[model samples]
Target: MTTSSSSSATHGRSPAGLDVSASFATTLHTPEHIRIAEELGFKRAWLYDTPQQSPDVWMTLALAAERTHRIGLGPGVLVPALRHPMVNASGAAALERLAPGRVAVAFGTGYTGRRAMGQQPVSWAYMTRYVTAFRALLRGETVEWEGSPMRMLHTPEYPRGAPDTIPVYIAAIGPKGTAIAESLGDGVFIMGIDGVSEEVTKKFESVVYGTAGSVLGDGEDLGSERLRTAAGPALAQLFHISYELGGEEAVKALPGGLEWLAVVQETPEAERHLAVHHGHLLRLNDADTAAWNAGGNTLVGHTLTGTAGDVLARVKDLAAQGVTEITYQPAGDIRRELEAFADAVGLRR
Candidate 1:
């Protein structure tokens, strides 16, 4: 059963899920990756939606839909500012036509997408309105947008009609966003296990924990090249977000954070935003490599990396804490990481 529907009586453990970066390198192969996940018993495949850093989310999901039969497909957390509500509704509808009940869309306030463009996240109020409008449009209802009423106008021939129901999820990290999710969303997506609170576990039916790292093999050290290649992108992301949210002072507080900040600051101010997220979730860039060399290993404990048994223990702990699903984003060798994690979680096709 999918994690969303899994319960203690029905399953022994929480379901494992996969999240992929919709980068140019992975977009074409994502369909194959999702197919593998389906074969390995992964319940869902969430694609990243950062236009500046990767290809179109919907287009990539559509491709995945055509390739896989059972795995759920959707944007992990689509940024509301990137597209209008009508546009998002249409994309979700198109995917619904292809995947039917397998589609679920999650909306976020544009943390990475907006920040990469030298902007701040959208307010919670705007996100709520956008989600409300998108849902109404999917239900064949007219909603006022920018002082005018608009609705989905698709017929049976063109893009076809939207599915009767599409599950909505909200990506939340704090109380304000959690409140919005509790009010409107069918589930909640969080960055780590700590984000899944007692109130959230009770309020939301599905609490998906998103994380990135490798399942370390026997005798593998965090400082090894393989481990760095597999986990460095995610580690570097923390620095990127720190710099974006708190600027130089905040980033410098991290391990190797000072040197990382220095390298990032070397970029011209006008293009610094672009530099910060150059590789994003796909791989590490030059600045990231420098940070890793300086002292990034000190922050290894913060990631999901561990031996197979250790990782499994972590997953069980999260499940016990009411995290219904764990979506792991694998860097470097995607297939190897997926297989290792699936095995560690005892998933079967």
Candidate 2:
């Protein structure tokens, strides 16, 4: 998995009268990066589950756990389809042994993970089953899997036999996924806050779910050239996702959508996944940045890119909309953007 730092930082509130907290999200950073985030006062660190591009999430989290103290650490969202629920249950239990109460695991329907294998996301029913069983396994309780009853064999070694202390966060984009999260997960993980409807936010509020979403860029102005360059990779991913998931009409709805669609059409289908996620969480190349910039019209529609104050305003807006936490995911220079976001949100060491 990759690295993505997120938390419902109730330890303090921002200066905007919003109780929301700021955190960081990384896709391919080492434990040292997570240590820096902890020092920067981010309440938690999330590791993304992108096996196609990053190292194993559990190993990385283990390293982070060893290097940092006081910061919450867990997989931003682990794709259930990639591993057996029992295996993940053991892994989560092991991680909790290392980090104790600081561990949390989120489950996603497998976006990049499945795409890399040339497959589609697993069904909601399948995910629900996995989560239910996984939760039980973490509780060190016997659960009916497949046909017979099963339980973690080594529960006697650990006090609870499972990592019941770990919270499970569910990543959802639609009503079906949200419903699964509400029923089976302790929290909800969203990609971006723009598409989250008021009705959905109300549901999340009612459950007091710890919500986390991506904020793409940073600058002194919302429409600054620098902001565009910084936010390019994320914007490109959006375009690619729209085209890949929603087809030609969806692409048409985006800014310079048609042009981006052409870029995808020209590429061999097999390579599209890698191309869309190029420089992902790291840095975008000049050509990719230009293509992403060309699709800039759709940037503001979903991303939170602007001056510090602008970003703060957007954070306030999100908090009002019921988002308890924000995950700042910037491209280009990662530390510069992380420090800028920390400064903007008044999160100090």
Q: Point to the candidate with the largest TM-score.
A: 1
What overall lDDT goes with each candidate model?
Answer: 0.78, 0.67
Clashes of 1: 0
Q: Candidate 2 at 117: error in angstroms? A: 2.9
Q: What is the lDDT of candidate 2?
A: 0.67
- Write model 1 residue lDDT over 220-281, tens digit each, in one string: 87799988888888788778878877888988788888778778889999989888888887
Candidate 2 per-residue lDDT over residues 1-349, each given as its tens digit: 2233334344334664444322333444657777776667676677777777778888888888888766778787789889989989988888777776778788888776787567888899999999999998878789998898998888355644238867887887788988888888776777773355667766664222232212344324444565565666555666667766887798778777766666656658767665555555445544345555675534654566656676778777777777766665555555666677677777763
lDDT minimum window of 10 residues, candidate 1: 16-25
Backbone clashes under 3 angstroms, per model: 0, 7
Model 2 stretches with alpha carbons more than 4 Å out: 1-12, 17-28, 155-162, 205-229, 285-287, 293-301
